[model samples]
Structure formats: C-alpha cells, structure tokens
Target: MSDATQNDERSQGVSRRGFVAGTGAVLGAAAIGGLGLPAQASAAEAATAASIDNGARVPVLIIGTGYGGSVTALRLAQAGVDVHMVEMGMAWDTPGSDGKIFAHTTKPDGRSFWLRTKTKQPLSNFLGFPIDQDIPKYTGILDAEEFSGITVYQGRGVGGGSLVNGGMAVTPKRENFSSVLPSVDVDEMYNTYYPRANAGLGVTNVDQRWWESANCYQYARVGRKHAERSGFPFVFVPNVYDWEYMKAEEAGTVPKSAVAGEILYGNNYGKKSLQKTYIAQAKATGKVTISTLHKVTSVSPAASGGGYTVAIDQINTSGDTVATKTVTADRVFFAAGSVGTTKLLVRLKATGALPNLSSEVGKGWGENGNVMCGRANHMWDATGKVQSSIPTAGIDNWAAGGAFAEVAPLPTGIETYASFYLSITKNPHRAEFTYNAATGKVDLNWQTAWKQDSINMAKSIFDKINKKEGTIYRTDLFGTYKIWGDHLTYHPLGGVVLNKATDNYGRLNGYQGLYVMDGSLIPGNATVNPFVTITALAERNIDKIITADLGR
Candidate 1:
C-alpha cells in the first residue's frame, strides 16, 4: 500500500517536523488553561458547588446529567423555569488525592471505577493477557456496568457520558436517520437541532494539514491506507476535543490529554464535555441547580394533580447512603441513559410505584450492535511510535453492508503497526427488559448468539480489507486470536421507544407531567455514534415542550 494511490488529503500534508515545530513556540508560550478554567480548582470545586441545595420543589426536574438531561435542563432554565437535576454520579470537577481529576488509561487506579474494588478496562487484554488490576474501591469516572449477557459502559459524574468517552460527536446519515428514528421530524433535526447541538458542544474536525504530519494521527493514516486499498471510503469523524489543545500537547506546550492516551477514563483538559458545554451554560442561567450523588429511585404522580413526588437517595463516594428524601416536581424528565432509565421505569411499573406506566415502557432495547476487533498490520505500515488515542477516521461501508467502523487508536506510545477498529452495525436483535418482582431487579433477555448478526455485518468490511492488505486478525485482543468482543457495549440505546412508549415529543403516554428524554427514547440502535443525535433530539423535544407546555 503506497501513499500515491490515496486521496489528495492523505497524499498532500505537512511534514512530520512541521506539525510539531509549527505550533511548538506559539502554543508553548501561551497561557496554560487556555479554556479559561481555573487551573487546580475545577473538578473538586465544581463538584462541591453543585452539591448545594440538597432538596427543592422545582418546576422542572431532570434525572442524570448526560446529553439529554443537560440539554433539557439548559433549555428549560433558559425559559425561566426553575430546574433541579438529580444525578447519581459524583461531581467530576473535584480532584482526588493524586491531585488529578481522573486517572490515566495506562495507569488506572481508584479513579477508574464506579465502586468496585477491581478496574474494568474496555480493552481488557493486550496480546491475549488480562490487563485489569484490583484497586481500592471508590467513586470514579467510567463505569463498566455489568448485566447477564452484556457489560454496558457508562460515565459516572456530573457530565455523564461526556465525562468519559472518545468524544466522537457524530450524527447519523440523513437518509438512514428516518429508519433509526422514524417519528423524529427530519428537517428540524438536520437543519436546526443538529447544527445547534454541534455548535454548542464545540464539535470540530481535525485539520488536514496537522493530521498529515502529527505523530498522533499516524495510526489513523494507517487505517485510511488500508481502507482505500480495500475499496472502502474513509470518512473523517468530528470530535469534541479541541484541535488547538491537541496540537499544543503534541508540541509539548499544554498539558496532554487525547494525545496522551487519556480516553475512556476522563480528559483532564481541552475536551468540551457536557460539564464544559451544556451543563456549564445551564448553571450560568441561575435558574438551574444540581444535586450531586443523589439518585432518583422512584417517581409517582403527586397527590396534587399538577406534579410528581420523587424518591431520592443521597450517597457518598463509597456508595453508602447517608440520606433519603422526597421532592416534588411540576414536570419530571427521565434523562438517565437507556439502561438506567429503563431499569427505573421497569421497576416502577412492576413494583406498583407507578402502576399506570405504559406496557411499552421497557419493550425496546439494544446494544447499538457494538463489536471490537483489530488487525495485525505489516511492519512496513509503521503506525507511528507515538499514536493519539483519539480516532479521526472511519470505514463507511453502510451502503454495501450495514456497518460503520471507526479507525480507533491504540496509543501505546510505541510502534506496533497495529490497525484497530470499533464498529457499529445493524443487528436487528433487540431485547426486552423485564422486571423481576421477586428480586426487585430488571432483567434483559439477551443472548450471546444474538450478536452473530452484528459480527457478520462487521466481518463484511474487515474481511475485504484483510484480504486486500494480506493481514490477519490479531489473536491477542478481545480473547483468543480470532474472537471479537461480542458481549459489551458503550452505546446502549433504546428501552422506552419513541412514539410507542411516549408521544412523538417524549411525553409519557400515561402520565401528564412525566417524560422520557434520554437515549432510552430511541428505539433499538442508532446507525452511528449516538451523542450528537441525543443532543439534537433533546433540543427538538425541549423546544416544543417549552413553547407549548411550560409557561414562564
């Protein structure tokens, strides 16, 4: 595979030295904390501040602080509605004993888990050896929440998924969007909400000039080289990480994050997560307040017809409940992600907390058909010695098959000529979450074999590339040499399906003041990365709700 055969973007780029030297002097001399956030007090101070106002009766209440929750809270607050959000996670703005907001992926500790004594790395192995370690249990960022047939990874903090993700902000293709979410108004999403969300989230594409020469993107270039050889189109995926800060890190100027292999944990700097974007803006409105470490256990119609009575538990970092309180809300929005919201709704319906919840409450759920596999490239490919953990490109073969695979980064900080990919495919194996009354738990009826369709869809792209590049699957990753990770998902979407479980705009079918506003409202799966869609949908729904329902 030669550079001559690739596109002009790949063939014509700055030299490696130019990438570093171009920004080295300029960024190195600039003030640190270029985002204007105070240096040491951000995480801890933010957490402490959000913990104020333990209980309140507000006009609007949001559960969880991810995209949906943050977006809804911000919009309602902007409309002069007093908003209170209850989050089960800790506030991530506080630094730990290490004086760091989060731990590094390569050197995970107490700051990497939710409350378990052991750390669960998404890439649990390297070269077929288990790489996880046992650490002291504490409240942490990334959560590998386990269930029967799957381990769903979620971020635990004020920013939700934004606290710990690859920061790949992607919207589903326009033509495919209709199938993924049939009830959504197409034009409103693409023309209004998507652009609005993108601008608010600070999503941007990598500069072609810098990507060509930067050592961090060498791994992406390798993936692009292989995809082109296999007749696949490599599309540039936008991200929330700041390009300037990334360049500064590569130039040895600002503190390193994405370029330093900090992902799936938390970025200490430069990533415009929800806490830095929507939630921060929401707080600025002064009408919105948040209570951290408070989980909404149940919500029932208030004796007075105008509101809901909510049950909450306030817990400490060690998962010890210190207080249980009740709060009333005029309107309640379930913004906990698909799993969390689904679990709450299912248990609420099954246990008689809210007996009138629709039967469709927990009917539709899927893993977004997520699967991971890697290819062992030839030494000549030379995926650089220093690789950026942030991915910038993907193999888009959705027309030929039902798969969109991102060219992921290894970021081992050493040359291995390895090609990595995390794929999202169309596997129609949706599961249902049934509440177990005896155990008071929510059970998902999903089987391991259910993922074979996803595996087959993903293999369609990799098989062609492997044959074209004369490479083979790496036996070390996921498990044995040729096996793929078929039982986990970082993108768990759907549960309370749209239009069926709720109205077109997320109003719960059976309740007047209740709504489902998170990824749970999405039916089954999204064709691409889901955060962008979640943000746009929240914006659209809240726009209608504010105009028609809530009065200032």
Candidate 2:
C-alpha cells in the first residue's frame, strides 16, 4: 500500500468495522432497536392509510417523507408539535407473492418502477443488446422520471430515496464545504449537525480486513488496484448498511441482502434506510403521522382561516386518483425531493394559488454532476461473479480532476471483466424548472449537452487509469456504441435554494408558515452523495425554525 493508503486506513481504524469488540454492547443494542423498526414503521404507515380522513385539520403538514421530510418531522414532533406527512408512494410494508417486500435487482418485477410498463434499468444494455423489458404498470419503489434532457431516478415511497439507493452516506470534504453551502455556518454544521445526522442515519464504514479477502469485493479490489496504480487516492466511503449483517450474509449465517445483488431497486435486509432510522424514531414519538399514497396537488392561503389549504389526491397502485380532498394546516413544509417540490411549487405559482411565492422558488435545480461509464479490463483482471451490490469505496480525485468516482459494482451474476463507475463531478451547469402553461405541467430546461461538462471531469481520473492499464471503454452496458451513461442522475438536488429561494434558515421568503426542507434547499450539488448534507442541513434549519418560528 502507498503511504496515502496507509495513512487513510490508519486514520479510519480500518481493522475494526463499525462493530468493534469494545463497542459490542452498543452495536447489539442498536441492532435490536433499529433492525426491526422498518417493518414496524411500514406496518404503521399502512394502517394509517385506512384512517386518513379527508378535510381534516393539522397543526403541521409536510409534503414528502424523504430524508429531509423525515428529519424535519422527527425534530418537530420531539419539540411538541404534531406533524402529518403526505407521501405519493406506497407503504411498502406488505410482501409480494414471492414473500419479499422488494424485488431482486437482477429480476425486476412490477414493484421495481413507478407506473412504467417498461423497466428502465440504469445500465440499459448488456453485451450490445438492449436489456429493458415489459413489466406491469404499478406504483413502485424507484421512479425513473423522464424529462426533456435527462431521466432522474428518484425513490417513490414513504422513506423516499432511502428506499432505493446504494446506501453510500458520504459527506463532502470540509475544505469544499463553502462551495456546497456558502451561506451556512460551517462551524455549527461540522461541530453539531453533521455528527447528529450521521448518528441518526446509521452511517458506518465497511471492515477493510474483511474486504481484502471477501469474494464479493474482488471487483472493488480490482478497482482500487487500478486507481492506486494511476496514483489516485482510493478512499473507503461509509454507508448506512449494517456491516455486521453483511458479514453474516457472507458466512451464510443469515438471509442475504447486499451480498445477493440487492440494490438500485431496494435492499431487503442489512441496509439502514430512513425507514429504520428517522422515520422509525419519528413514528415512535406518537406525535408524527404519515399518510402514504397521498399526493399534494396545491397549497394556498385558506380564505376563512389563518393557515394554508392543501389539496391532496389519494392514488391507487395503478397510478389512478381514487379520491381528492382538502385539508388545512397552520404550517406547511415542502419536504418533497428536489423534483417533486420544485414541480409542485412551480405549478401552484403559475396557477395563481400561491402566486405570492418568491420568483426563486423553481430556480437553481441541478443533477448533482452525475455521469457513468464502464471499463473493459484485461482477461487477467477478472472481477468476481459474486459481487456485493453495496459500494464501500471511491476514487477521490476531486481536487485535481474535479471528480469523485465511485467504483460501482456490475453484480450481473457473471464475470464480464468490466469495471463500472459513477462519477460525481464538479460540473458548474445548473437548470431551471419552469411552468409549462402549454402542457399544463412543469418542465426542467436541462439540455442533454450539459452532461458533457460532467463527462470531461470524470475522464480526468478514468482516462489516466485506462492509459496506464491499456484498457478500453465498455460500450455495451449503456448502449450499442455509447460509452457514457450521461442521460440520468441518481442524485437530484436544488430548486428552492437556501438564502435565495428561502430565508437563510429555510423559511420561505414571501410566506410565513411555509418552509423548504430537503435536497431542494441545496444549491445544485454537495460534491458527494448529497443525502448526508441534506439531512444535516435539515437538522440545522429545523432547529432554528422550531425555536424562532414555532416559539418552542
């Protein structure tokens, strides 16, 4: 190992994973407390659906049940405020005919996509053949929403993006913090909110010793080898999955999740999604209530009352609205992920419902500088067939290359001698969301060519490695001749940015009880996974909102 690698490992205490011998008691207690909460929260949300009454009044209402939504709900509920969250997706509590809550990544079913007859796999092709297939149109976990320029993959469930991600809980470097959130207090964030968010999200690094010899991680090893050979820093990234449970899966001592190719769509076990963390704790408080399959259509100041009137639609699994209802709330929070929140706000303003809203409400949207590609390795570099679905490492070349590339897994159940990657670059292009009065919908003005900036930034790292290893780009995974998967983004950020769209603390500029809490508050990108920053910023904003706005 190089000196940089040795220093990185030593600083992280790589020999021991999250569960060290001295921390056995703490880890055991946390497992028993958290591992079973997702199922319970799912069951509770399902039960709450039947009791969701129309025309009911609430003290506080949140638009989405994503990371920011969940964090906001929990903190507000703890501060003696009653919160009701509206989610446009299913509860995901019940098992399918296969006795699993989520579908297998390699065998996608109706449960994989949201209202799409055809499955839009990120890697759309294999061996020069298109791999998408027809599936039943249903309300599913992952939403591959198509726009004019890009397809943004967002999680559509009570737990939001936590339901369908790689569980990579990455925080941006402190030196780059100013660019991530220039208006926020860096000292308070680093000293207080980031740590709280990480603890709440259950972030932990993989055991490096176990990784060195594990068959499932041979792909990561190969990726690290190539990165180090090119003089790049191979850093271990943290995740929200339970490393102990993954070790059990590797030993065949438990049912598999991460080790059995269970990501993208959903992870059946081991992953500590928001359902097992903030959402679970929020439900336990008894002051927080979530209504699944409930989509908010409009928000306006109530004519007869001193609060906001919200229009909601209860939808079925086939994406049909079964009923529409109106509710009043003293306070409203837009916690929907970036796209959902921006779309709703833009439409409401355009239709004159919330016309007083600031002009910046639907501006400053970005795709988090996302791009993907694959490299065909030499015959001697055979990545293992039993690859783990969860990524645990990345190549940090952001300073020199403006790219932080994740050594993502192929997990195709066969060795194809290919190394796949998803690079989060420092691309400086941002798009805007505008109300398309012609189509009666919101449209993002993101051009496909904007991705070229991302492609160049990513090449700074991959090009050097490919040159050193004499490898060629894999053109079969994305399309017949396409080497860059630049059509989509797994991380969607910004819209109602901090200080511009909202007050410095997320309070809407033109409205008093309306708050913007979520990835939409972030301005474009966080230079990393983005969720940890999203959660931490929510933590900071809600603290101030409760004390100042709610008088708590």
* Highest lDDT model number: 2
RMSD of 1: 7.1
* lDDT per residue as tens, model 1, 44-127: 334544453544577788999999999999988888888888888877776655567877666666667788777677776555
lDDT of 2 by residue, 425-497 (tens): 9989889999988889899999999999999999999899877876767776787789999999999999999
Model 2, 115: alpha-carbon shift in Å?
A: 0.6
For candidate 2, what is the TM-score?
0.92
Candidate 2 clash pair list: none
| Residue 520, model 2: Cα distance from true site in angstroms | 0.6
